[model samples]
Target: MSQYFHSVTLNKEKCKGCTNCIKRCPTEAIRVRNGKAKIIKERCIDCGECIRVCPYHAKKAVTDPFENIYNYKYKVALPAPTLYGQFKNVWDINLILTGLKHIGFDDVFEVARAAEIVTLATKRIINSKKLQKPIISSACPAVVRLITVRFPNLVKNVIPIQSPMEVAARMVKRNISKKMGYKTEDIGVFFITPCAAKVTSSQIPIGLDTSLVDGVISMKEVYLKLVPILDKIDHVENLSCAGMIGISWANSGGESTALENEQNIAVDGIHNVIKVLEELEDEKLSDINFVEALACTGGCVGGPLTVENNFVAKNKITRMAKLISNTAVNDISNTLETVDVSWTNPITYKPILNLDNDMIKAMKKMESLEKIYNDLPGLDCGSCGAPSCRALAEDIVRGFANETDCIFKLREKVRGLAREMMELEGEMPPPFRKNEE
Candidate 1:
């Protein structure tokens, strides 16, 4: 099994263990125990939902510090399309790209430009191949992980194309190396990420064995440094290479729109995506040609690490996208033709939710789990730190929790013990008999 490296982590000091994260976690990957939130290593998808919903700011995404850029001889900033949506009242994308250079990057590459290439590549694939119905986009790492853990059957439906970030990283590194006579190793490509999923993806890629981007810097962290410099730079020497089609990818429905497919559906927010994926798995949406599922609401702009409000940022991106034209590069076919966009390795299902590795043992455990679940109150009250009664039963079978953790069960047990104590007291010899003698 591959070792999991999660971006989302708990800060023990800040966690109130109020069951907020456990309730919100789609995969039931979290449990509140001993007054702290614990993430199950096998089940965590790094969706950053816990980080977003945590009231006490206990959940955090681990990202590379800005100073880590100095580790490379040559640094390139691969800004996500969502980064353009961060700055309020800024329409020109070049200003944001240039601002990255001011922050100490040797060169700036737009992940959006690579998004344009991906758009073209995806279109080509859709046209050429008779793929499974409602082919899911492989762009969202969190969604991919979700499918792996929860809906393993739909893994085949996921498009095998590399993400825009990876494509851009490869292109930028190769181009920079050729131009500046620098080795590819010397040129470090850092992705300016909008969520913890991207951080985890960069560290341990899903489809690919290694990520082209060297490090991931959270958008919230970069926003602080970029905003002050956005105004200071008078003239942006390097204009944005990506057009509206690519830049619109920051918001929901952008990818579907770019695909120009009438039968495509775009779903945002992890829960909504899960619902749609469930429908797809049930073969309910076979008519649809494609499914653009973004883990974050309103797409990348709404990511947990982003500084701006998702709705507001989406509006800004929409407004900016209107002004920009699709004039970047008319033909990405040549690049797509040469590049290896397909997955190098196969993506297998992760049976994290399964009771056991052994079929017989798993079946036995399932029977026990069902029995335990039936015995519970089935309120899904989350009082026991698990999301639902079923989840608590699973935890109990897994030895992470017991029936006593359930408040109702504990209450009933306490009442039974009290009754037994009363019955034993009634049967006991009178204490005053010795004093009378």
Candidate 2:
């Protein structure tokens, strides 16, 4: 069964045949062809790394417009824990929340509160032996998707818990619907997202059959509209329900701090996260009590949204985390005991890559691919739409690419003509030699 959602999209007309995305992609899901870029649907993790690295800003993430909120009578903004770090030098969290109302939202809910709950729940997950060794963090949808596509062997290591984004969506709907006397259908919870992966998560939830979050709006798009009215929104001293541990969710060290187990470790950036997970797969992480992984380096501060520099924003967040009183995540765990904080959605165990499936068909495809690859000049030129020459060969075998996919094949024709000209000159001298014989 093919599962696709309107998440990350390509703006073909704007593409400049740049290899920026090909190199930056963690999953190597994109290929450059005919001076344009295309995404392999099954392989894309929707990390939005392409969107961030594109010089032309050609890569785009599909999202429901802000006007879609009118579909429901009561709309709420469930901003991700990462969203809070977007604001710099502004200590007041309510300034951002209140601004959501002025920008057409009816109410706001902090996803960090959900993180506190998730931290507690994940602790139980770690303690339980229902999963394979070194359970991977299910927080980043892109990372989860990466595991499914490129590293199917690691899927067993993925934690079964739904992401905090989904958890927060469920909490928001439950709280608002009961308190405000509104039905679940009447309340729309939109996430203020920093990356496209979160948008993908909302559309095709990793662990859940359906998503609780209604829609997603990019922090980049929202910030463009919010920056102009920063001073106008009425500010309260402490509108944030989250303590320091919750706010720390925006950084790499966030999970370790929130868990406060002393043996926990937090890792950020896709490359680093993958490395640590690999080490864990080998049981090297048995000594460590916990692992927090983030796809983007420096955590949400390095997300594709916000105008502030990531390093600058990270410094600001570090200071902010220190100022707030440290609250134990266990307190939250104690409160949600038997409160049904477990994932309300159904979880599926199917592998996305089918790596362990029958190898006969794959072997045949690989054999044919090797022949085609040998026939063509081995240039990793983006002209074939694959990231490299080797990738084109793989795509051809996978049935997603064709023989004419290479522009270098046409270049070889010109080289053939030059060789023919050299042979013609030798033929003229050969005629004279035949007459002498």
Candidate 3:
């Protein structure tokens, strides 16, 4: 039921079994075992905090290869707005697009273009909704997934619109197919993404099942292949695919400004977003009209796949914003009309919690699991293969692990077992061997 496995993986041999990742994980997703760290896939949010903190650099995200472009008759590379920051002095965005051509892509599509549509959709929703203030952006998959798992109460605040990457893939396929006289099936749209979350988003879109994207290549992989070719591409066109509103999607508060809302607030970084979300839950932030919360600081520029310094990339994006036209998101909606913008309905919109389609069964499970959780060590050491002590208890109730399997509790039980065994032995027999030896 997971969209795709986008979490960081360990090179078991390289892992030093350190507790650094365990302490840093928001979800307590890593556990040290047999002198190596193991990932709890179901609990991992794919935020890549483990990859960032790992001393040996044993953690790596799996990405699609560039050769995947050949899977279709025609291929289009949809680069995330963050990909632009990977280069130095790359004033022209088309240089990177053309560079994709040199690297084997037949065509290039900007995810920023799709961002334009999302910007409009979100603005429309914000303006039209009769509900509460502080509409949350659903563009960042990690932030979205975090809400689904940890903060289900805020789900209604999440604007239910397709992410910019999805929109770009759909648009490019439709427009290019129409322009080139080819069928939609003949075109392959690959998103050049910034993190594992986007890869997961492409594989399993939240509100939809089949994604518009055909494949995904991370920024880390793309940068390795494109660095040498960046300067060599001399015949690049001036793409101008996205305006300021679209380009701003790469940074913090980008969506808020794009929507032209005066009362909105934007916060970046996972901890910061969590604090704001907590405030939202308490109804303390009810006055704000919109809340743009990104799990990564500096927005997509700080995503795990990006190679450039976050501060440096943020500056570059800021500088780039000044050169482009400052078109509002409302203006960009006109462009989407010509493109085939239909979406597969309700695929990504299901509730992830099994909580109580049947309330009686769910309540009984919760009560039994609550008692088990109370007995746990609360260390969240991940030794039992669940992410945390509470998660381990849930797993026990779910029938994946037994309550006694927790190493801390097991050691305690073993001590009690030893005492019981000694008591059962009664009086001990005298030794036959000589004590002088």
C-alpha lDDT score of every prediction, in listed order: 0.89, 0.75, 0.78
Q: Estimate, for each residue in 182-249, the C-alpha lDDT of model 2 and write its tens digit.
A: 99999999988877788888877776668888899888777777778878765543446777777778
Give the per-residue lDDT digits (tens) of candidate 1, residues 1-437.
26989999999999998978999999989988888888988899999899999999999999999899999999999999898888877888888888888889988988888888888888877988756767899999999999999998798988888899999998988788888999999998999999999999888887898988899999989999988878889879765778888889999899989998899999999999989989999998889999999999999999999998999999999998899878545466677776666778768898888788998999988999999999999899998989999999999998888999999999999999999999987674777445555
Model 1: runs farther than 4 Å from truth? 429-437
Worst 10 residues of 2 by lDDT: 347-356
Please report the candidate that would top TM-score against the real structure: 1
What is the TM-score ranking, best to worst?
1, 2, 3
lDDT by residue (109-139, candidate 3, tens digit) is 7888788887776666767875456788878
User: For each candidate, what TM-score against the reference?
Assistant: 0.96, 0.86, 0.84
Model 2 alpha-carbon miss at residue 103, Å: 2.6
Model 1 residue pairs with clashes:
none
Candidate 2 collision pairs: 31-385, 32-385, 33-385
Q: In lDDT terms, how accurate is model 2?
A: 0.75
Better of 1 and 2 by lDDT: 1
